[model samples]
Target: MRRRHLIAGLALASSLTALSALAAEQGKPTPTTKEILAKSAPAEWRRPDPQNLLVMQLPTGRVVIELAQDFTPLHAANIRTLVRQHYFDGLAIIRVQDNFVTQWGDPNDDENGDKDKIRSLGKASKTLTPEFSRAIAAKQPWTPLPDGDVYAPEVGFSGGFPVGRDPASGQEWVAHCYGTVGVARDVAPDSGSGSSLYAVIGQARKLDHNLAVAGRVLEGMPLLSGLPRGPEPMGFYADPARRTRIESVRLAADMPAPERPAIEVLRTDSASFAALIDASRHGHNAFYPEPVGKVGLCSLSVPVRDAKPVH
Candidate 1:
């Protein structure tokens, strides 16, 4: 009887141990927020150079933009020149086209339109040669995406920027998406000077040909996007009084280092990036009903994070 009782007791203990192991295998361990962020984040995330930064102060708020140096060096330099002379301060956003762009600077855009322009181009040239698109070779390194693109033969990220390239023509230009800032020109391709510029605040207008797109507003899309559309044709405000005020436009380099906004952008090429893409497409959590298989080029949001702890 004693021997039988010992065997039964040992079996019961073994079953309990097996049950515990099964429970451990079945249970999904909850990942901490820090762990998720760390695992999802890449080590190669970079901060934009203050010198390349463009700070535009609107009546609503400040809009921070990063100029693409690799694509449009000449235009970027010209903009920097304008900023140094304080050309944009006190200027007004004269155009807010519905489902289009919100353009600022001299409302009198035509050569004959200027009566007494407050925003004068001190030393900067009124016109610049059309830098519509440039040649793209192996020399110009760009990480092409796996998915096929409708616009170009190759679509990818280059020099930490979203871009599209045509291998046949060996050319690439800035895509016309929301917040895309370009020089407004007439029928003449070379007519567009750095002075009369516009920012795209709506859908990506892929049809813009031979126009010089200088830079893009990186942070504050809403400031321009959310603006009330101009009542007149081409979204140009007929009345000057209704326009939004531009307090000032300054290069990040010009501002004191302490006053600059601290921001970090994630690098496209990294292991953590691969994981992030994977996680974003197919969610592992219970909240997600169905896993999304793919994400578009613009859909993949390059997150802008505040590096320093916010109070």
Candidate 2:
């Protein structure tokens, strides 16, 4: 009788082990959320350059913008010039259209060739040639999204930046989405010079074509997202005082090294990154009721973490 009991206990233990194996095979983790992340994260996450960072002080809070040199090199360079000259030092957000963009710059420009007396462009040019789109085959490294895009023939991430491309034309442009910063211009699309600009804080306005898309707010999107709606069309506030003043826009590198933000971004090509996407699509955690089958590229929030000095 004792021998029989031992055999039954061994059978039970084997069954439990098999069940655990099955759970793991289903890509479900037995560990807590924190434990899973600790095990999944690799060491090669990137630390962004302080020189590339854009810091905007809003009345509400600070918005950190990461300039995308990969897509819009000229605009990024021009922006750096404006920043260095303190051109946007006291400029306020002149427009805020609900379900659209929040715009800032001198609104006094005479589009019809009238005399403009509000302000003068010190060093920044009043007009600039359009930097609308560029060739996709410029040997730019890109991560093609699995899901196809409606706007272009292809859509994916290149150089850690989002992009859309037309294979037939060999043309590509940065997609406009929330936190997307674009050059504001008059009726003429090519008139945008990167002086007057706006950032998309709402839905992806695909209708905006022939416009110059410059950079995006990688970190501080919430600062623009939560602003109150404007009364005017296209979100331009009628009153001047209502605009949000930009204290200064400076590259992180120009500022003292100690004052920069410490951040680390995950490498998209890493194995751990693949696992993260899988886990995110089909959430096996206790809170999930239905396991999702697919996800959009834009929906996936790129993971960013605060960096700390390794002792």
Candidate 3:
């Protein structure tokens, strides 16, 4: 009986080894994110519309944001107006909540701040019909992830932004992924004026479908996330001196042609991007012998690169 059992175990091991060899012969492992990007075609990249690009100059470096006008046109327009009016210029980054957000706006707008010192909104509307979520448009680019979400019925990328969707309601909203920029508001839904904004330093998925996502930060996230956390509750800085001052905020359209940021973003609908998604799911290497077959909505980051000068 012992001899028979040993022979059976040996046969099973031989079969497993054969299966492994067959699998290796059938397909090569998915390329790494870096390798996939290196092979991407120039057509896979897109230059953002100047009107939708915001250049926020900070003490450390420049932070570029691309407004998702298709999702929240009103908020985008309002933010554009505020930017044109220089509403954010000279304002300070008032809060840096650990593992939450890096908020920037008029310091006087806070609970501990002097109401009288609040900066004027100028021509921008003080209140807007809250654009928390909008009806999903069929024409919009949709790169759906097979892996289901915890919050919404489905999750995907629309126009380079991580988005959550509910087919039952036909509503889609931007997910609060890392580097997502959201409009700050009071309890009242109409209170958001696009004057104050916060960038997610962590995956604050709970905020999805709750806050209006103004845009996504394309560059200079380290400058925003690397700041010291505030001593006050909710990351509000008690001492004004701790806040980082905003040098200026300008729309790319307003800048000189030569001075505009020479940058491009990988198109979410491009083949390279789809490869990236697959790579995130199944790519394996020496370090990671086993690939995690599922990828979350916020785990993917659309690639951005400095545009090569047209010779």
Candidate 4:
């Protein structure tokens, strides 16, 4: 009877252990990106300075851009001068290259348009020295991406911009990713005056070193990128009527304090951002049998949120 009792007791203990192991397995599912962000601390986000924010209006919607003042101070200042003068108010989106870029400027300057009617630059300069890339000093904030890049020795984020870096040459420049705003220049390298800007809507790694990346479109990217492609060569619109009109472009700081768009961008160095990256690296579920386990420089879109509204 004692032997029989010992066998039954051992069986019961084994069953309980199995049940506990099953429960532990059920509770250990990998957290998704949504879950990680939901658990993020408040301090992990930062509100962009009003001085750095640009609010642009089109017939379809508003586009918010964060000027890279630290990376391209001259260009930022030039762009600010143009905005104050309302240089972009009546201008239009003149070109959209399918899987490439959407360019906006005075319609008369392009080949299809009459150069005789080119709009005056007003207080803005006609040209400036190229700020295509800058020396990568230690003072520059870098949040390095671990994955290898095809273009450069190192790739990372600096001041909310995707950047490629070369420690050997000590040079770093913003990578040409979707929604990156680049200054359109004439044949001369220094001809870019920020009068005309192009937003990358598709893959354009080739333009990284050639053009000066001024800023990034934080909002209304779909409105710009999803527009119909131009029929003319190099994405120029043969007819001015087909171009999208620019209603206005205003600096956020220039607006009333209450009317300024309240925005908070997730800090790249935050714990949440680390989690976001790690999740992208090793996350797996029933839907995905294979985890990518690697992330590229441009694959992660920086998170920005509307903090509050005036109304």
TM per prediction: 0.79, 0.80, 0.90, 0.88
Q: Could you give me the TM-score of model 4 versus the true structure?
A: 0.88
Worst 10 residues of 1 by lDDT: 10-19
lDDT per model, in order?
0.67, 0.65, 0.85, 0.81
Quickly count the clashes in candidate 1: 0
Question: Which numbered prediction scores highest in TM-score against the true structure?
Answer: 3
Tell me each candidate's RMSD, in Å, in order: 12.6, 9.7, 8.7, 11.0
Model 1 TM-score is 0.79
Q: How displaced is residue 56 in candidate 3, in Å?
A: 0.7
lDDT of 4 by residue, 1-311 (tens): 97865553322111112223344235444555555666768788888888888898999989999888877889999999999999999999999999999999999887767898888889999998899889995776678888889988998888788998888888888899888999999989999999999999998878987888889998899999889899988788888889999999999999998877788888888777766665555444433455465778877788888774537
Where is model 3 poorest over a 10-residue stretch in terms of lDDT? Answer: 10-19
lDDT of 3 by residue, 1-311 (tens): 97865553322111112223344335533344566678789999999999999999998999999998888899999999999999999999999999999999999987788999989899999999999999997798899999998998999998989999999999999999999999999999999989999999985999988889999999999999999999989888989889999999999999998888899999999988887776666544333445465779888888999999977
Better of 2 and 4 by TM-score: 4
Best by lDDT: 3
Steric overlap count per candidate = 0, 7, 0, 0
lDDT of 4 at 193: 96
Q: Clashing residue pairs in candidate 4, if any? A: none
- Best first by lDDT, ranked: 3, 4, 1, 2
Q: Give the Cα-based TM-score of candidate 3 against the true structure.
A: 0.90
